[model samples]
Target chain A: MSRLAIHGRDLLLDRSARGPSWLVPSLEVSRGERIALCGPSGSGKSTLLSAFAGRLAARRGSLQVEGCELVGASEAVRRAHRLATMGQALQDAEMISYLSTVDNVLLPLRLAGRPVGAAQRARAHDLLARLGLSDRQHSRPSQLSHGERARVAIARALIAAPPLLLIDEPTASLDPASREAALDLLFSAEGTVVFATHDPGLIARVDRAFDASIWREP
Target chain B: MIVWHAAALACKGLAATPIRAVVVVFGLALAMGLPGMTVRTASHIEAVMVERAVRTPVLIAPRGSPFEVTLASLYFRGEAEPRVPFFVAAQAVTRGYGSAVPVLVGYRASGHPLVGTSADYFEARGLRPVQGRLPAVLGEVVVGAGLAAQAGIAVGDRLRSDRVRPYDLGTSQPVELRVVGVLGWSASPDDEVVHADLLTLRAIEGILHAHEPAGSEAAPGLGASVFLPVDLSPETLDRVHAHGALEELPVTAVLVFPPDDRRRDQALGDWADHPELQAVQPERVVSVLVELLVRVRDLLLAWSMIVSGCTLALIALVLALWRRLRERELALLRTLGASRSWIALLVAIEAGLLLGVALSLAAGFAWVAPVLLLGALG
Candidate 1:
């Protein structure tokens, strides 16, 4: 039921100090699938993820997630859909720092005003356990190793059962074995995943790949 | 469980910025504590004044200002005794009115002023002496609790009048007044006064009389001693005591214990007719002080409410901005399916928790401030 569909779109992201219209976009995504958005180092891989999460404006064309129109939605509704229906794992290390792993997993539920009961804890714990972090449930991201913290971030993004789990360069800091383990966990995720990474080995495992440079606007 | 999560979030956030938390708590305590202590002390004074008013049921003084007469006669708060027509007391009692006792309140024992009245002063208003017997003669004294403790005075100790004033400038009194009694605890205003009989008050007249200019003596009119008695009855007191004569000026004010309110009013009406006399109820004067105290408390309450509101507003504003800066945390919460309202609630809960701690600290400081003020005064 996670139809994380995207339609014709354009996006402008300042890739260099070069100019404001550095990267523009036209793109699409659908549910129960994994799309690896890839390009050379300066390509708009992360920008497409931001646009998919509705955190970035396309400047043209329509976009949607969990069957709801995302672009041009009210600021509140866009933020709501982004936090609630979409599971977003930032590739950047400067993610939410003050909260513990368990609290971080429950962030969307907290925003949704749902009771964070034993059931939610169990689900979050199982997700962390799958990421081989059963014992690190209460640790802060700062305390975890890069690989371990990336896995925890991925688990946190997926804990809410959102229609789309968006991950950005999750394997950038992972070692070979941990990177393969992270790929296995993502390839097996229940909902659709739209992730961007420079890793070619990681891409061969995904259901599909889109060269983000081809999707960019002129 | 939601509360637990909210508390966990607040603790994490506040723990990250301990300096901000400490400053907020410090500001709240200072804002709330100082004014509470000052207002509380003023309230205590008002309480004491109100208690004094009710406890002294009647007052007698020479007819001038009613409030001044009441204050001077009962509270030692103002000037000396006035010229009372001694014979008028006889008329008051004969007309089925109450018994009247005169109080001469301006003498001092060991530099602390004494209140002089009859044994009826203690009986009509039940005050017990803590030690030693009642004053048996002119030189005998009965000291109050405060007067005794403050001056280090005790029974049988002899004291001289330490008073040296321009009006009463003379050699210190040559009399040896014996402290025959010490009063028990009476936390009322009377605890601060030394008690003596009317004869002791008239004792001043004797010392001043002999010190008079040699040629200024008038008929040597029955030395001041002739006005005092060891065993005085109304009959013998009038017959032998010169000041109790038709001619001598009367004692300060007469406290009449009228048989009933009707007799009191009748006595009051009778006194009202005379140009030089008046009757007053301590109850009415006390009610006025009570009214004043209530007004003061209400005024303080309004100001305190304003301070409290400001403290809450500062707390709320700080928390709101802090939450805004912590949007990453809000995003994390939201990504976990937390609603906007839930995130706001966590922030609110954090504010309430900090407020609770701040209020407790301020209350503790407020309670301690009074003790510190009283200690400093002591």
Candidate 2:
């Protein structure tokens, strides 16, 4: 495994036509470490996370995930690397409305071209059980509560046992108890987690915290 | 694996919204099937009509609309006005033209037209009994297969002829004729008519009557109405006689069967100059009718094809809207590592499945529609 899960130097994130760009002077995250991107709203925390997920091309900077350059990589290369190594749970859980809870949790494996054998299924069931969603496995996304859908999304992200996890506002819709449980599940998994959030508790608990608000250009 | 996943996703999405799927399926089926059905039905009707018309080479009737004369004589469907004398056809036969079977079809029995003619009518038409002998006497009737089935009449059953003028005391009363035979299935209008001796139909028209008994006499001062016996036996048939000369008796038309085409042409030409009679080749009249039907069928086919095209466009629009509704979900899948090709595969599979089912149903409907139409026509 690469020691540096994510390495970057002077990265410029998302330069839109009408919006100001945000800059990261330097950043480094190690394998098995949990880092928090802390900032106010519109401070480019989410934009920086999108850059880390290889979804957005940085305007100017050197950025690499697990020793593979992503700053100027082709789309197919970035997508393949992301599918092989990274798991993402964006805001709102983003569950497919037509799929049931269990199927939604199994989507990552299906997309990765991985055969979802009994072992993978058992792991998915275990993750959902831990997240208090075993009873709702067969229920469609529309039938589940917002928090339950969030838990299903978390289960989906962890199903492939990806080496890097990128999450945005994972505990926003959860109550205190469910928040702690979700955090525990995420930290206990074997991977480096880089999450963007405004939660002080989450920032304090991470191995390192980077404030993105200062990088937001006026 | 990717293809399987895409297909499964598509099936699940269609099953999730069953109403839309069903609506699109049956709508497409109707749009595709209707044109084929209409074309087949029209063609079948034309073939049957043309075949029946070809069998009867010449028709001699009173001077009138040739089409009307042809239909009334061959199909017993319309009224041929100003009936001609039976002798007009018989005189042509006497001139070595061909045999003429007089058709007097102005009476009904059990809601079916009673076509009165000589025994030669059966020989001319190549009709045979499926159950018993053909009508050999005046009061005996031969029912067609279709009429027998519809009216529930069989050989040896008695059928009552409807009165021509029930309110007029001078008109003939209802008479009972014995069903001597049921004709075989001919797939023609003959299958729905009741064939009897011409004298029987003439009796029903009040042009002929039978006396009550040998000793019965009418009062000289008062003219009494003569009512024919309801049941005509050998005794009643002996007393039955025509009011006019036999040669002057009225016949609706005459179906002439010539030995060859030359004889048929000669017969038609011979009657061409007659003052009160007209000769028509049935095939020519029916061909014109068939051609008109073909035009109508082509128009309907074009219209239905347009409708099918519109239905296909509507279906495409519905699918586009469905994709729009699921746009966010697709983005979510992409974010979760599904490639663009996989999503394209899913949409293609869904559309292909719907088209396949619709086409299969359309084919099935096309195959069965003509039979149902022919049955309805009968």
lDDT of 1 by residue, B92-208 (tens): 667777777677666666677777777877776677888997776565678877767867888878765444342643433433467889888665556677777766555544422
What value does the TM-score of chain B take for model 1? 0.63
What is candidate 1's CAPRI-style docking category based on DockQ? Answer: incorrect
Going through the candidates in order, their DockQ values are 0.23, 0.51
What candidate 2 gets wrong by more than 4 Å, as runs, is: A66-68, A74-77, A109-126, A200-205, B33-38, B82-163, B166-251, B256-275, B301-316, B364-378
Write one digit per residue (lDDT tens) for candidate 2, span A151-170. 88889989998999998888
lDDT of each: 0.68, 0.83
Error of 1 at B171 (Å): 13
lDDT of 2 at B170: 62
